[model samples]
Target chain A: MNQTTETSPRPLSARIGGGILLTAAIAIAVEASTFEVAFLTDPVGPKALPLLVAAILAAGGLAQLFRPDIDVAWPESAVLTRMAGAAGSFVGYAVVLPYVGFFLSTTAVVTALSLLYGGPPLKGTLAAAALSGALWLLFVSVLGLPLPIGDLWMR
Target chain B: MDALTHLISGFAIALQPLNLGLAFVGVFVGTFVGMLPGIGPINAIAILIPVTFAAGLPPESALILLTGIYYGSQYGNSISTILLNVPGTASAVVTAIDGHAMTKAGRGGPALAMSAIASFFGGTVSIFALVLFAPVLAGWAIRFGPAEYFALMVFAFSALSSFSGGSLMRGLAATAFGLFLATVGLDPNSAIPRFTFGSLQLLDGMDFVVVTIGLFAVSEVIQLLEDTEGGQAAAVGYGRVMISAKEFAETGWTMVRGSVIGFLVGVLPGAGGTIASFLAYSTEERINGANGTFGEGDIRGVAAPEAANNAAANGAMIPLLTLGVPGSGTTAVLLGAMLGLGVTPGPLLITEQPDLFWGLAASMYIGNIFLLMLNLPLVGFFVKALTLPRWFLIPGVAALAFVAVYAVNGSSFDLVMMTGFGVVGYLMRKFSFPLAPVILGLVLGPLMEKSLRRAMALSGGDWRILFDSPIAITLWVLALASLLAPALIARKGVPAE
Candidate 1:
């Protein structure tokens, strides 16, 4: 059923994404099949919907893997680097958030991003400080929502 | 008269200081995000959902804040469309045609004025229609049983999928992926874990807020980072921001007609603002195409589309409130928000939660008034926000998104999950898989499964029970019809009026 339709040189990227989806689908299906009960309670239990999802996903992934859209635009390395930096910083923020707390961590992340987005360091730093301070005050004091007070600050 | 009384009480709830302030903040932020090129209402609402929840506002107030963001963005979209020619979403693309042209002709101020005016006309008129139609639809929907509701959800999925843009297969794939995500937590009925993979956080399922933010907001940052060519800053109003009486006279009927058309179109499943504006523009062009300079800098062109798009935006809300089905991606997010707030929208929603239904309706009016107030006299202030370095604006929003995700579960793992979903989202955007259907599927999957099983259980596991009623049958036909609509309409060429 595979069609030789894909004309793009980097069609492997499409296949990779599709393969990931296919793998996820197969894994979900396999996991769902093991769900058991003392007796079948419903005509179609929870397994049915997921199995259907897996089937659809498998078909879709196969379709995509076999015949990828050709006009996929890949970003240049420079732009790709910036995107990676932004994503990496986000992950780093996630990693350090609990330890660094909402305030300092937020300031650090925002400042880094501002610089990445092309802000002067001084302006970025000030904006980050202001943003973090304002968010801390609004969420904590005004709204009375609890955000983590950094361990660093507490010590 | 009864509707009026209900609406008056809605106004009372809406008039409370906190609710009012939330509405103002919602619209203000909505307009700001809506005007920004890369960010749209979906991202804006996604970014705010966690914050609103953390604030511990009553569900109704949170709903009010979110719905404000919904239509508020409609008003805000015009600012960039007219000034910078970068319409935030496909809905505003038509507006940019005449809107940007008018700017070039030194009529940017009046163009902005007419857009706000037309949008206000659309917003208010559609809200009035919503008050009228929503109750009637809800009353009719109260008769719907599980089978009909199931069929209706199917119709929703199909309609959304067919209109999910580009490939039907890709949309289906995205939708299936969303359904798979929906199955991640423990199965509500069987009490069995489906795909948690032995993680504690997976027990409660993926939070829609985190998923939505990851899918829309976080991915957007990655996409923006990849874009080398940035938009030029929009010039503030050059001429009078207020349009002349002559200009109003010229476009008065166009605005009214566009509002009517937009509202009608918006009420249909998947026929959203993009179609509404396009329809309104074409209709107006047909009517006055003889003498009017239709394309290049015509104020009526701006009025027609802006009115239709805003009206359509409000019109789309009707189904979300009354039928528990959303007509567009934005409304899908709204539906998700409403569901998260513990409001299951359906026929009984009006009777069950009059405050939410009427309060939201009333607040739309209040929100439109605020949009008018903010956009007309204060257009200059909002425009200045555009001049702020993109570096600052994008990152700041990204930080807000991060904080919002962290606030959801107070876990770094969720942030990691958000990051992972961001990558998935970025890939989905690249592969042209429509993101909204994934959301619709994720939100509606449980309901779909529940209705399916309930229908079967009611009939002793007879699957044919799903088609027992005429309503169910009709809905099934409509579901199939929706998938066939684009093709049929394309072939028939939108038959003569």
Candidate 2:
């Protein structure tokens, strides 16, 4: 549906994605080549699948590079910033989870995401806290799966 | 008679309190998530995989719950399509054309009722067909040697790549990336690690759960964020979810035809519900010719695609259960869950795990009944849930995803990796790459590699063994044909899209 006319230039994003894929294929092939084995355990060995994958990736990358798609609708900068913020919170939650404990870190991340999605601060925090407590009860108390107690609290 | 007897015994398992309760939960949750935008059954199943594992349910019970979600979502997807004009998944896309048109004409209630009935009809028909055909297919598949299995996997990869609704090259690339990820961790044949990069965490390879959640659920979250403008609130009142007898008469034959078409298409690798529904809709349109209101809110229009997709969902289970090769993304995830539950689905699965096989079949019947009841009398409740603010709903889904990803191995590092994948998945979506092929390749790659190496080992490194057998050759031909057919169709100017 988003076909480009023959005269129109291809989207830069498509070409960039193609180049990256091509580079990845080369990297995969190079890494696969180094996989040496002293004994013949199987006729194909470990490298076959990866090499095959590399070849497929190379073919796809070349095709994309030569003939790129017409249009790719990237999000606006503001939307991108929100996405980055959400991604940042996810990474931060993982990094600090062991120290901050599941309840606190989960609440923080959810609240952060809620704000990004445009919730009122008080309502978002309340909902985040409620969700965090519910998850803790379900996973830790009921399911018997351990959630980190936070070294900060344990200490 | 043998299948019937086994099915009866399966009802005993399906009727058990725990299994029955799980089936209900699965369908209920499936409907809720499926009706909602941005959280399709794939995300729901992926997020629940770790939770299901943690709960320690038996393999059959876990499967009943998971498969209930699979088909239940098919029924639920139509609700949003009819109500909000938002088709939840690709399969539901065709439904919106007529479904939303009916809603605009104040016939939304009848449309919803028609969707429920048609879904029920389609689901039951396909399940019956599944029971009849699966055992027969399994009986034949049991004779497949390693070479045949290798060819079958290749066919799956090729068919999925070709039919995944984009350029074949992009689909192939996605499949290759998934295969590359599968090659990470320890090489089972050799003691060497191929792509671990010296990390202890990489030794286990990519946990399909983490990868799936990241690719589907988390990426969905970021993608949803792209459209920060809140969606239009669904209209609260539909007179009542009921269809007149005249309407049913108009749609009865349509449903039967749709179910048959859907089941056949669904049995093929990669075709799945989207194509099945499209084919069914076009067929009905052609049949109606000048006499049909078709896209302008005809009841048959609503019935056709809904019936076809629901039937296709069940039809997909045949290949997954019999051959242990899933044709679509959702079924592929189900296969991953089955493996995680210690159930190896193959030709022997029916004989060895009758309860798992037959019980699943029986529970589908119950799940369909539950979906009907939920969609009909309680349709208002789900529509009400549509009005919930995005801030509360989306964050809630994100939180659930985080817990699910974290629960997989209980390591925070996986959470980080999930974020990385989420970003990658977002880019892939932006670039028009298909995500299903990636999951298919990741799930099937190891088995594909194992079958290939085993075939070669048996033949003492003879490359020709891959094409030596008739079955293998047939499968190879099918794979090649699937790849080439699309190109040929496009050349004919028939508008394959």
Candidate 3:
């Protein structure tokens, strides 16, 4: 079995693409193993589809290993840092959502992302907050969709 | 007499003030969504599904709006392609060849006008074809059995994988990944949750809206963040939006033929607008080899693919509306919208819901007319949008995406889920693991599984029953060929244009 290439000397696009295929292959294997447990129930239950999917994924993974062509450029350090910051902002939004409400949390996250992407601080923050507030009103008030309105502040 | 009468009745429904208004909104939003780099038609359809649902529009009206956006975005995509050299969607990739070249040559005005004219030609022509062909396909499909449908779906999967470029194996894997994502929630036939890990949210399986938003829109935000030193597209001088009569006369037939071929190919599952444009452009290139300027700012080159892609966009609607089987990502979103609107669009739909079918068909004609009118006069206004700096546009789009995602579930948790999918989407893009299949799998997965189980039960567990009917056999063969043909052909051929 040709082991999936973890790192590539080629462009960043190829390396990233290869890495993803590897991750996908591994994820499928894990999902497939979980699916095997379903066989203990109904004889022809849900497991068969997962197993078939796993086999197809494996075949595709093997194909990539053999004849990879698309080149993936590895992201620069600053880009990686920005991506991490974006992720962090998302997590922060989730954590603060209930306490602060959708408006505050989303504004904070969007502003954080804009800053990470090199937007000027004051302008980005204002734009982010304004956008978040506009969406909250539009979805909640006009559309009648229920959104968390923060027990702490709204009450 | 027959066609005109039907078309007039269609206009009755389409020209209803409310329906006309909705169609306008759909195309207007579609153009904006398509102009943004990385957020394609799929994202627009998926994001808007819930909003339309919440608005409580009638099923036919809702469909009119959604379907309008579906094809309208195809026209919107070229704005960016010509101005920025960034093909926002796969179908527009061909447009960039001569489009950007024209811009660099300072003929941006002519290129922009030609794109609009070609698009208008493609749209009008295909809607006529749709008017002619839809009922015929529906009539034939009505005779098909569940077994035939199961096989047809397999063909759809195979064709998509084969045509997805790079390696067939990788495409199949991407398809499999999509199918796997589809299996995440609950089995439709059996109520047991398959991959949900006991979460109530998974009970609905994967929401196509959530997944699509995560995959396309959210991932785009991450990409924008990475390109810190992003390049802004120089806005071209707003010249004449009208194509000179001579120019239109030169490529008029090419546009007609391209539209015909593109519409037909687009009706099939797997090969969608992307293939249609590629096929049309290559065919035009071949036919006009010497006389044609070909790649070097050939007006025919622009006209053919632009017309074909637009026609193909309308063509893909046939399977989605008539058969309830979606062959592409955007159509998959449309199907989801249909289901959400409580309209089951299938073989029986034509006979059972003639008004819906005829009304949607009519609305499309009106939508195209509106698109032509909207695109030409307002081309300058939309082109001016390109002048906005990247730092502003990218972050602003991301903010809107975040709100759209948040709008769906009204929970920050969905935002988190969206972010996770964004990362996955970015990886999928980087790896060339065809994102469309994931969507195809997610949308078609339940249907495929239900068909499989039903076929098995009918035959008392005989697997061969799937291949029993001639139609089934043919589809299976096509599916197998779709899986193999790309590897054999693409392995040694020129890189995908």
TM-score of each: 0.94, 0.97, 0.93
List the candidate 3 regions with Cα displacement exceeding 4 Å.
A1-44, A63-70, B1-6, B491-497
Sorted into a CAPRI-style docking class, model 1 comes out as acceptable
Where is the poorest 10-residue window by lDDT in model 2 chain B?
B228-237
- Fnat of every candidate, listed in order: 0.67, 0.76, 0.48
State how far residue A100 of model 2 sits from its true place (Å): 0.7
All candidates: CA RMSD (Å): 3.7, 2.3, 3.8
> What is the per-residue lDDT of model 1 for residues A1-155, given as tens digits with 9 covering 90 to 100?
11123435677787887787788879878887898742355777778888999898888788768886635667767667777887888889888877888888889988888776667899899999998998888778987777888777777
Q: What lDDT score is found at residue A115 in candidate 2?
A: 96
Tell me how far the alpha carbon of residue B96 in candidate 1 is from the true structure, in angstroms, after superposition.
1.7
Query: Please, what are the lDDT tens digits per residue for candidate 1 over residues B1-497?
Result: 99999999999999999999989999888888776767777777887787778877898899989988876777777787788887777778888888889888889899899998999999889999999899999999889888888899888888877776667677778788888888888888888987887998899998887898898888887787754237647455558798988989999999999999999989987747878898899999999999888779989999999999989988888888888878677787788777777889888899999998898889889999998887788888878888777777888788778878877877888888888888889888877788888888888888888889888778887889899989899999998888887777677786311
What is the full ranking by TM-score, best candidate first? Answer: 2, 1, 3
Residue B360 lDDT in candidate 3: 90
Look at candidate 2 and tell me the lDDT of residue B443.
Answer: 95
Candidate 2 scores a chain A TM-score of 0.91
In candidate 2, which residue pairs get closer than 3 Å at backbone N, Cα or C atoms, i.e. clash?
none
Which sections of candidate 2 miss by over 4 Å?
A: A1-10, B492-497
- Give me the TM-scores of chain B across the candidates: 0.95, 0.98, 0.96
For this target, which candidate reaches the highest DockQ against the unseen true structure? Answer: 2
The candidate that achieves the highest TM-score relative to the unseen native structure: 2
User: B153-175, model 3: which lDDT tens digit per residue?
Assistant: 77878787777665666677778
